[model samples]
Target: MPLLNNENKIPCYIQNQLIHDKDIKSIVFVNSHLPADETLLVKSITLVKRITTVSVVNNFTKELNLNSVDISHIFIFLDNINDIPSASSAIANQEVFSLNNPKYYFLFIKPTDNSRDEIKNILDQVWKCHELWKYVLVFCMETEWLRIVSYNPFKQLLVEFQSDCNNTTMFSNMLKNVNGYRIKTIFFYTLKSSKMENGKCRGNDCEVMETFFNYINATNEEVVLNVTEDLLYPVSQDYIKQDRADVMFNNMFLYIELYKYSAFAFAHSNVYAVVPRASTLTFLTNIIFMFTPIVWIGIGIIPLIYYHLLSIFDNYAIGKHHVRGILISKYVYALIFTCIFQSMIITTLTSPKYRKNIETLHDLFESNLSIYGVKDWMYMFHREVAIRYKPWNNTSITSALNNLTLDGAYIVGEYWLNLFLKNKTRIGGTYNDYYYKIKEAVGTGLLTYYTRRNSPYREIIYKITLLRNMAGLDKEFGYREINFTKALKSKSLTLIHLQSSFVFLSVGWILSTLVFSIEVITNIILQHIKTK
Candidate 1:
């Protein structure tokens, strides 16, 4: 047995009892008693063992920070009392590795140096910074006793554990239970993605959050979760900075983030909007659009004009004019033209045409119609929409629903998109193009949950995200345009569904402009000729 001291027979409880399960990331640090056989360092008891001197501890720590796994189970043994002060700095530096990782540490001092004041001094030197112990579990071994310091994440406090059993049994149990952390009071800010209804926070985003927090809130009967939709802080970063919030339930990922906290992601959503789909053609234009300009002159104009001229000639200068009334049949042309016109009218009414959808951001902005976006979405992605090009910024949630009968478009975020569509379906009871979601997404990244850099709850939140995603719990509440795309494909017709008609109207407008130009030129030429 590795001696705790020259005469003590404690038997190194960890070296003998630890059952390595292939996942325990164990590391051992010894300052003296070098063994020539390197294989002992590679055994199951010590996956990573290093021999360190006082002068080289800092270098070793830096190397470990760069190469070690995010979480660590470390056992550090010091041979000399003077080594504590230097080891304090090196051990404290290990806490700086990752914002989301946790560390379980066991520190054993020489039997002569294992005083309570010595442990207190080490705490002061290593954890002088406030709350650095949040993600670490510290175990200090004594000859006859074990001292441990743990942190409660929900309550946001360091707790010294209390045990009724003897040190040996408690020490063994502590090793077995070191894998989990305790819970306390938790503050969740739901302002970023949820709306307040009768003092209850609710929305699409809140529902997704409930998939995790609801499970967590019920995980322990003692857990206290204070979920609030307070708007006192305008942004999520402010809530974290003010210490009023422990985590942001949902937050937009901005290009320039304000917090240094770890972003714990729960939902991956993209922005979608219910924009207006405008018609490209009109009723009268649809008729003209069915036939080319040359066909128009040949089928109707030239035939009528030629017949009229021949009639005048036959009445006067008298060609025999099919003399015996062996007829020319004008009714034949009438029947044919009438049948064509009737066919076109029926086709145009049923299958109206509209402008190609404003699917891309460039096209939506360039469409030149007024656009409105939710105030929160506008503020979150303000980098892309900084300039208020139009005075169409929505000041309220009710504004999105108002677009159902209105002409303009509204940008609905992932959180509000589903609710907005539901309200639209309820109002119209059928499909309408006035409030339709564009097929493409507008945001740059996924929405995430934000926690403090030293937050002990981050690991739990990560696990919840993993398991919830694996079980498809939150996916039911995620952003979906599948149904909306189906709505657009529905055969039901409405006044707003006149897309093909608008295309016809545009073509008619072009032809009208061409005719107007010719008439103006001819009038100008006639005036000049008469003046001369």
Candidate 2:
């Protein structure tokens, strides 16, 4: 038996019996005396015996890799009362080595070190591993009676800081109480990327982000937020000027002095960041059907006009009873019908597929109209749009709007673009070119919130986002376009449709006038000859 003291009063059999009763798999003896060939009666259990000194105990983690090895039981035998303080300090520092990870711990100490201060210090180190003592079995070996006490680590939380926070004013404003978990704030603003670490980002602040960050650092919080690391990706190169300046001028007197000089002049104008909304502009199928009526009306009018003209000719000159007149009229009617059908068929075959107008991304690509994007950035996030438009960065959307170039198409969010287009009366266009959308939306990124690996508040935030999305808040936020139920009315004719009508009128008038003039000239000549 490893002697608890010089007397060695505790029997090896009793210790083995207690250990066997508990069914402990592995045991680690620290600063305990045992023979080189010592074996416990329980052959199934594994034993690691170490007679470590104070110096070795302090640097014990170096000798043993706790992550790779498993020790179910830990027996720390305090040799001297003075060694108690050093051992406690060593255990506290190296708590990661054998603390909450073990399934069971058997700590054998002398009854003399059971004073209030000594016991408190020893237990304090044990609790550092988070909610200890559930698996711990403490025994104070006394001469007459053994003193055993059970401690529960979770009964009272030791104030080793309840929460953590990064020093930012926005974070302070956003996270409210976080389900009653007190945040122990430490100002250290760090980021994995130039990613926006917030769910609801507005300019320079984010309420969702602050709340999430605070909730993440809290000790008792166990919520898992379904969020990505990068909530918003600013395509601009100079997004992190604030974070960068903070890092560079962190200890600089001159930088602080310069900030004082320039802060008021810029004010908050340049401090906030704005991300453009992402969504596809879909083609309105309803609008395309609106033009169907006009096409039918135009085709239907051809036969009607032909019959009306034949009736007019019969009333003016040729009687229906005359065989020549009847044959001529039949020939003319056949020719007219043939001409109309041929023209309709040829035009339909030659022209490209019918699109209501330039509305969808596919329509934009197919149209002869040039695509205009931002001058500073390429709006190539969506692959198909990027490939077709190939985004011209030389001219901006603002400039394009200002110019109101009739030959080009501009890509922008629906709400703002619609508003702009509604007010754009200066541009002389008969078509409502403003209300257009791409049918397939390019899903490049999503706006999401992040939490710590295990946070209790995660599910709450997730549900909030789901409800917001379901309510179509994206439309409210201008990420989605207005749902236009009404289709385009093609009753309003364009130049192409009127061209055929004008040609028929022009030819009829010209031919009638020429025939009348020829008849009048012949009559005058005959009368002149008779007078001569």
TM-score of each: 0.47, 0.30
> Over the stretch 192-291, how does candidate 1's per-residue lDDT look in tens digits?
4577789776764466555545545523212233333333224445655444455655555532343345455455566665555444455456556655
The reply for model 2, stretches above 4 Å from the true place, is 1-356, 359-362, 374-384, 393-395, 423-463, 467-532
Local distance difference test values of all predictions, in order: 0.44, 0.36
Give lDDT tens digits, candidate 2, residues 250-284: 01011221221111110000000011211123223
Candidate 1 residue spans exceeding 4 A from truth:
1-23, 26-70, 75-100, 106-193, 203-234, 238-244, 251-268, 273-356, 359-412, 417-436, 440-447, 459-532
Error of 2 at 105 (Å): 22
Q: Quick one: best lDDT, which candidate?
A: 1
